[model samples]
Target: MRIVFILVLAVGVGLAGFAVSIAKDRFDQYQTALAEQRNAILPTTQVVVVNRQVRYGETLTEDDVSLIRWPAEHVPFGAFTSIEELFPENDELRTVVRIMEQDEPVLLAKVTAPGEDAGVASRLEEGMRALALRVDVSSGVSGFLRPGDRVDIYWTGTGRSGEGVTRLIRANVQLIAVDQIADEQRNNPTIARTITVTARPEDVAALTQAQSTGSLTLALVGVGDITESETVEVSTSELLGDVEIIAEGPEVCTVRNRRGADVIITQVPCVN
Candidate 1:
């Protein structure tokens, strides 16, 4: 029994040692292979585009870029071989691509405009704000307004607050543009397609209120004097004191003819 136990113990110890040795060998081999691969990748110069425009359908290639900016810094050098990876697959964007040529950056701008007029957008200079306003003509409702045209903005009233009561407190908001001049000889006088107005701070509220209260009404202002003043608050008494008011006095009923007439006649009692 003792011999058998000793033999079993020896076999167990030998097996455990063998397993540890195998594991150590595999670990060393893996570390050596990983170091060699890392060294090999570090020495090669990847041909990458330094700075160029990335456009749609542009394939990524190793020759597109020279010196990888930084794998984890400027751009992920290892993941993307070309500029196409920077943009979404279906995105319509123009990206600037860069590539190193003799250790120098060369830039490029790619275009992704689809059937869009480049001239119209390019002509719009800096510091100029663009606003889109709806315009209508006699032909029908039209929004095909070009960059240049004169128009008047008007609001319409629904007249819902009884016939006697005023439906609109204030109606008719004029043109919205401030820097507008009309050459009537060049354009039509009676009709306007869309009225774009340049308005001051005070006028902006008036126009905004018009949009809420009533339908906008467009009235053309020619080369005449355009004067606008700040509104002053005044009571009804102050506004209408000078105006004539014809009001009936208090009712005093008196008997008229024998035929019984319901007439509103006034008379003074006779003193004997």
Candidate 2:
């Protein structure tokens, strides 16, 4: 029994030695491989890991490159150097940069078309094109004419018949985009209200004529109706003339005494 116990103790000692030897061999092999890899690539290239956090809004400039540095341990895995494992000291492996914000300047202009008057111009903005047309704003009739208001266009023309009587030519016109930029006018103290309208090279003359002869009345439409052209055409005659408006008489009256009331006011006033 004493001999058997001694034999078991010797076997245990042998096994422990063998395990230590194996571990030492593996560690040497790993160190040799790492050294070889470092010699092969470390001189020619630099591997750095970032230490800070970067955000999406941050801008990177060429001058910011000096903040990166190499990590402590170097090892080779298949293709890549196993950067994450070997470079445990690196958090971001790059530098966190902050970017500055800037504001870009812009210019806006207001333009008007012929016969297209102020009421129409006010509704216009910077990016619109004007097709000149005549509109009638007799007195203060078409609502309170202002910039940015959308209106339907109506055109009227006079046509001579064979019998020498004048026939009325009437049709609907589209009030394209308003030509003036309200924001620029309101914001800039020096800028006046102008409107932009879309027009062909040829229509400029007809628009000017329409402004002179015909009357354009604004037909206020909903926001959805203001966009896109359904159709456009030249017509003669008046649109607002078709609608009759009643005016109230003066509110206050003056009274005269007998001396002034008996005077004959008409026969003696001829000045040729």
Candidate 3:
């Protein structure tokens, strides 16, 4: 009876140990699955951003920026992922072309190329030229125009028929600067005397001629407005609702008589 009792007790202990081991393995698998699910839900990436407010024409340095973890799926285009990408060379640096607030992402469009200055030339793309136009308060959209805004240019001058005409000279032209101010953050109403724009070679020529021949006015385009403008021209007569009328006279019929050598032509009434 003592021998049988010892074997049963030993078997019972062995079964309890196996059950505990299996439970421990299942708990480990549960922990690993939970970690993988958390990672998938909140994936992130490191992005370089400005630590302090940086203004236009200011040199960007290593100490002025920091890296933060941003959502991998929503990262902005042209955002720098690492410090080395923003500052490629130790000896060279880039200048800010637009104002960047604190903690803002450093974008390629807001900064100049390495060793380049913040100038109008840097803002222009290939095959584009910067052109300046003279403007006053009335013609410059009451000093509410900004650098990044699009505008429609109008020309007011005398027409070939000796009438005053106002026509749309250019549509959807982008303004790069207003009176030497290229910062898009500027909101104060400034009566600018000159505004700079980027245009193709042909447009530059046409704008230059239009500026010299007559007065030019700027019409501000709304943000995200991509509607194409039609050919718009207004004359002084049209503005006053004047219409020209033509009067018709009675029809006259002529009868030709062949006399000896000369033909005689006389007006006669039509029978029909």
Candidate 4:
């Protein structure tokens, strides 16, 4: 019985030692593989990446972003290299101009200036004035108008000669907003009651006068299309070929009295 017990004990000890050796071998292989992976990685740049999903017009903060090691050769233009670069002086007050997804690099063009909110004026170029014009379905291009669209402004009303006329007031006017919204994300078609456009200061007075004296209409132009040629003024005659027919003029006729006045009446060619 003693001999049998010793043999069983020896077998159990051997099996345990074998298991430990296998575990040690696996651990050493794992460590060696991890080291090899680290050595194979290329040098990277610490780039600021969006830590979470960010929507357009939403302000960004430090917590909303994180640093990621991007390959140095593949870094995009204007990519923020560090947290400080993304938020200068640790200021996180920046509005997003475009949507950002998690792990995406943050670029200068994607965010507004520090402490700047995403306002309509922020989208304007230098020396441009944002002018809001009232619009309806017919004038607003039937809700197909959007920010960044260009349009030709047309004024339609009676002229001094009492003839209806349509004049192209402004050409290639940039449309910046529909109603109060200026988001590019809101592209759904809607009948906007007003449209905001950017125009030069010199053209504001003309636009104001056109809106007051005549009905203003918008004709959307093709994207990226600009026509430098001058547009001609149009009237009834220009639209219809050879529309020279004169309207009937009033004629002079003598008054005719009925037979009941003095038992006699004078006819004057049935009053013409």
RMSD of each: 18.9, 20.8, 11.4, 10.3
TM-score pick, better of 2 and 3: 3
Of 2 and 4, the candidate ahead on lDDT is 4
lDDT of each: 0.42, 0.38, 0.94, 0.86
Clashing pairs in 4: none
How well does each candidate superpose onto the true structure, as a TM-score?
0.25, 0.26, 0.72, 0.64
Report the C-alpha lDDT of model 4 over 19-45, residue by residue, as the tens digit.
999999999999999999999998988
Candidate 3 ranges with C-alpha deviation above 4 Å = 1-36, 39-44, 243-272
Worst 10 residues of 1 by lDDT: 163-172
- Best candidate according to TM-score: 3
- Candidate 4 wrong stretches, greater than 4 Å: 1-53, 66-79, 90-92, 101-105, 159-162, 224-230, 244-272
lDDT ranking of the models:
3, 4, 1, 2
Report the C-alpha displacement of residue 266, candidate 1, in angstroms: 9.5
Error of 3 at 144 (Å): 2.0
**Per-residue lDDT of model 1, residues 1-272, tens digit only:** 99999999999999999999999999999999999998876333332443443332344333444555433334432344444543436544432222123433323322223322222232233443333234456321233222233334544544444221112222223332322322112233433444444444555666567567645433333435354423332344444566777998866555454435555555755444
Ranking, TM-score, top scorer first? 3, 4, 2, 1
Best by lDDT: 3
Q: Model 2: per-residue lDDT, tens digit, 35-112? A: 999887633223322233323223222232222223324322211223442223433222111211221110011112
